[model samples]
Target: MPENTPYSLPKDSKAWQQAVDSIASLLPEDISLHDFDALQSLPVFALIVVLPAKVPALDIHHYVQSWVDEQPSWHLVTVAEDAEASFVDVDVATNGSTGTQQPFTPAQVFRYLLVPVTDTLMHPGKKTAAAHIIDDQLTTRLRHDLAKNYANAQATDHPENAALVHDNLVDCHILSIGHMLRTHKLACFDMDSTLIEQEVIVELAKTAGVGAEVEAITEAAMRGEIDFDESFVKRVALLEGISTSVLDEICARLTLSTGAHTTITALKALGYHTVLVSGGFSYFANYIAKQLGIDEVHANHLDIEDGQVTGHIQLPIVNGAKKAAIAQHTAEHLNIEMSQVVCVGDGANDLPMMAIADLGVAYNAKPIVQARADAAVNVTGLEGVLYALGYPALVASKS
Candidate 1:
């Protein structure tokens, strides 16, 4: 390679060694360096050395499978290219020269191999770690070079038609594998309009014989016409003294919007720390969470006395703002950045939580929410949420 080539190594034929040195200097000095030469043969096109929020060695990729299996977002980028895809094993040794080689998995992007999820790179400690000294300009330049290279590969050799390919890229490069590989965390979701399904509440209320009244309140609350707190109080009060068992009956009659189940299940398997933050009651939320093995559940707790509702709700109803608070609390407890969290909801009440999460998904949500969310999914199943998080393939059915 020419001396001026951007990806070139030093004149000493020690590009890998020098790269190791640079990487070592950024990590703990007590750590050793293993053989880095094997990494030279692969095309990494770009590299992003980031500081993890917490749990520096956290294996984020393990939780990333669902996104790939479900939405297959990254496939869009590769679809635009003719480059052969391959995986390369890279060993990241923190223990200086004495470090032993431990198997590290990295995806080779064209010529550039990436260590996308490195908890060690971002030392999560009270004091700033030594690795922070890498020149920002150098890192930025390296990433830009990578993005440029990938862009070229997709534009030129990609097999799909130009227009369709162009349309896909234009719609979102954020969902591409490059972005996912570059991203530290992913947020998955349930759709059926929980993040976007249009009228789950209204439809259900119809069966409950309170469609018109419930629909009016839903409309008002969603339009931000009435205080969410007050609207919830009024709405639930209308359901007062209704049979608590009616909820189970409601579940039997419930109809999930197009993508509800698939999206939730896939995200759960992928380790997104999924939560059923719903405006709906515990009746449905609990069932959905249990079936999907969701890590958290937040919904209206039906105030029941003697197998019947007390004609009242438990104080501090789970409304829009409360939903947001729960999500924030989870992020804090996990010691993760809010950006690592995801919130999905459909109604006006869901807006608060959606607004607060790192990636708010307006799943089949109200138009107002759709306008405000970080992303939106209109795909047939909740699985569309997997796509929003940058997965490009459908999850294999688990028996």
Candidate 2:
């Protein structure tokens, strides 16, 4: 690699001095460099570099293929220098695929700037060869090759990546770039019907022969037809006379949702703060949390004395608003942006908290909940979340 300057320009930096210096050394002498903005708002690393003089509009379409093959990260967003027109501002989005973004890794970043200097841009003398050798056909071919390489890498690196596998299987046209996984610092999950299969209230009510009644309310609560707080109180009241041992029984029989284990494990591995916030009973929540290795559990505490339900809750029922409060609290405590947190549930009450989270997911939720959530999954497993996070099917399956 040639000893070239890296794109070390920070967001706040006024000029990409190195990029400008390089551009000036190659392009026509009249083409002067100007200011540029690091479009940080985008999910991918994009920069909108501006120039005072009009850029070359030559139909050097032949260079497109070479540029694509040689510089996968560079895309000609536009070619103009008009001040009032946004088209004049070049939108340069980074190809964060395997090779491009790898240089920005922690290890690479610490090892001095790893600039991408190819033989094409090397200095032969005072004036360097212009990179204007690109054409439309070449550009098209390059894009196709880059996309193929990206897909192949995805398959090789993450065979179980569900979305990629699904797309490939269906032969869907995968967009070049879209949603980027935001840095989520916190994650919140709903207990019953989401994290775990069993609803503690309905199961406990089974012992009292009121299973049908409590279940109806549970279903209604999840469907968003009934008030979560009221429905919960009515259900708990039915289970008041049951023995506390049943809690353990329910815990023993509880089944974790598909992908729950992998999702939580992966999130934890990535240093994400997770919480189990549920409208379900704490008895089952606490036990299931332990089994799944969760960091926090927030649910309704059953009022049991002498190993029997008192037919009443202790205090502070975990309602919809309360759930949202807990999620916000965790985000604030972790000093993470709200957008860096994810809340997931499958019930109507979960809507409040889900709305507050940076990313809200409705896992096999009722129609009402699904419509309100940012993302909804109707599948049998929790792994669908991996898709929303842009984890190709292969990676999700592996973990």
lDDT by residue (216-309, candidate 1, tens digit) is: 9878887778987787777766665566556665554444444343444444444456666666667666765664456677777767788766
Q: How accurate is candidate 2 locally (lDDT)?
A: 0.53
What tens-digit string does per-residue lDDT give for candidate 2 at 246-339? Answer: 7666666666775576567656755677799988777778887876679999988878888889888766889999999999988888888776
lDDT of 1: 0.44
**Candidate 2 Cα deviation (angstroms), residue 31:** 22
**Model 2 stretches with alpha carbons more than 4 Å out:** 1-181, 395-399
CA RMSD of each candidate after superposition: 16.6, 16.8
Candidate with maximal lDDT: 2
TM-score of every prediction relative to native: 0.53, 0.57
Positional deviation of residue 109's Cα in model 1 after best superposition, in angstroms: 19
Best by TM-score: 2
Q: Residue 33, candidate 1: how far off, in angstroms?
A: 22
Error of 1 at 74 (Å): 21
